[model samples]
Target: MRTTHAHPIAAALAGLALLATLSGCAGSTAARSDAAAGGPAAPVPAAAGAAAADEKAASTSEGTAYAAPGASERQLARTAKLTLVIPDPAKAAKELRGVAEGLGGYLLNENVVTEQKDGYYVEPSTVTVAVPGTKLDDALDALSKIGEVRNRNVGSVDVTTDMVDLEARIASLRASIARVQGLMDKAGTITEIAQVEKELTSRQSELESMLSKQKALAGRVAMAPVTVTLRPPSVVIQDPNPLWQGLTAGWAGLLQSLRMLLTIAGALLPFVVLGVLIWLPIRVWRRRRRPNAPGLLASVLAPATVDAEDVPAAKPLDAPRDRPTTVDG
Candidate 1:
């Protein structure tokens, strides 16, 4: 026998072929076993292909979810309250509306009151507008230009963590949806199918709800809201009817006078009491300190006494009585 040596390339090819055969056999056996066990009997390759498709869809949704975060690194929502005093309210209101519209913002709320004070109506004092976050500063400047800004408050809320968490949740939900869909596909019995479908439906609803929340959050982050308040100048009301006005004014003045009097009395009452308490003790102490000083209370309440040195001497009536008595004896 001529020594027959196998070529290395041929040996490698044979090994690969044998391995493929064994893999196919094992795959077939596994499929049959799964079918007997009332599970998915699809070939492993087909299942892998489906799984690949699901992952691709999941990845697509993940990309969509992250798009907002990439655009909103700052993720700061801003709001402001403004108090302005304008000369002409109607003109000022119109100007404010125009400014909001020019900034590509819309008035979320606009209210006008027809009630007039003096001769003119007070334009709406409250105006709520929503503008792009980038345009907020410009909008505020334009609004300030319209009139003198009495009060201006600017506030910001950082939502970076919230937005980031929302994206992560969305990605997780997409993955869960993919898993449920895979379960739905593998379900063979009607009961299994119904159960899987129910779960899938519930998950899908939650996912959609989360999507809506994400959309709203993203919108708020992108657009900033600035409120421009147009305050009309102060006006005094001049009623045409003066008779009733005079009567009411007189009554009001009387009541005001009484109130002021009562307020003064109330304020002075405590001090008066305190002074009386203090003066009583001081008077007592002063009288006790002075030797000759009689108490005012003693002079008013006690009877006066006379001393023996001040008594008058008996008159000669006593001597005459003594002489008459001796003669009679």
Candidate 2:
């Protein structure tokens, strides 16, 4: 019975050793799916979104180029500042309002100031609007009719590199996060689970931050700003100097000088006090160690000396030594 049991135990041990050797030779099966291990790379989803946007933009430009023969309509994405001077403010305003409404563009901001000049009227206006890239030309054409078009300028910035780089970074982070999630699901040990959770949290935060950056960039590219400044045909004159202007200016100067003085004092007072405090200790030490003057010396040293009248009379030492002392029985 002992021999039979030993044989079974030895067989089981041999089987376990063989299995471990096979597993060691095979290495990890997980590496088959990992791109770093000679595997095919995974598709980047965020990159696809950016690529689609570029394709759409290209298609849009082509469509606009072939819209009509001898058509001046162009698809442009840029920021512009326009200044217009018209004879009729109300009429121009009404006409531009219809054009803006028809273009699907709305006024983001508007300001109008009306004044009387030489018993006449003058209106100065400012409006900030955003229009679609496809309808920019139409919007600008309609707005130019409102005034003399003093300034028709546009500024553009190319963010292609920035946007593409951001997309790539976002995609990489998302891939890393997915891998971490898988690891978290498979992790059985407490240490491994904790590590995966920490990594996932970091990746999630980074992705959110990158996403915000992407949105801000997209908003900037999608909507172009057009600043329209409208002024009256004629100039308005005003008094060069008001009555209370000089007085107010003088008062302001006085207050400014007072503040300057106060600031200087605030900055210098600590150094001044520190210098005084430092000088005080040196002055005390010098006084303590100073050489005495004639009067001061006399006053300080006179008590240590005794006058001849206050001294006790001294016996003659030579006479006492000359006489030998006899021994007493």
Q: RMSD per prediction, one decimal?
A: 18.8, 25.4
How big is the positional error of residue 272 in model 2, measured in Å on the Cα after superposition? Answer: 46
* Reference-based lDDT, each prediction: 0.65, 0.60
Model 2 CA deviation exceeding 4 Å by range:
1-77, 87-97, 115-123, 236-329
CA-RMSD of model 2:
25.4
Model 2 TM: 0.47
Candidate 1 residue-wise lDDT, 1-329, digit = tens: 11222232223223322332333233344233333322232222356346635764665565564355743577887888888887666677788788889989887876655577666664656677888788888889898998988999889998877766655555544544554565555555555566657766865787688678778887887778777777776676576678988998999999999999999999999999999999999988987899665566678879978998899886656443444445555
- In model 1, the number of clashes is 0
Off by over 4 Å in 1: 1-67, 70-72, 120-124, 235-329
66-107 in candidate 2: lDDT tens per residue? 221122322234787889986655676666667777788776
Estimate the TM-score of every prediction: 0.55, 0.47
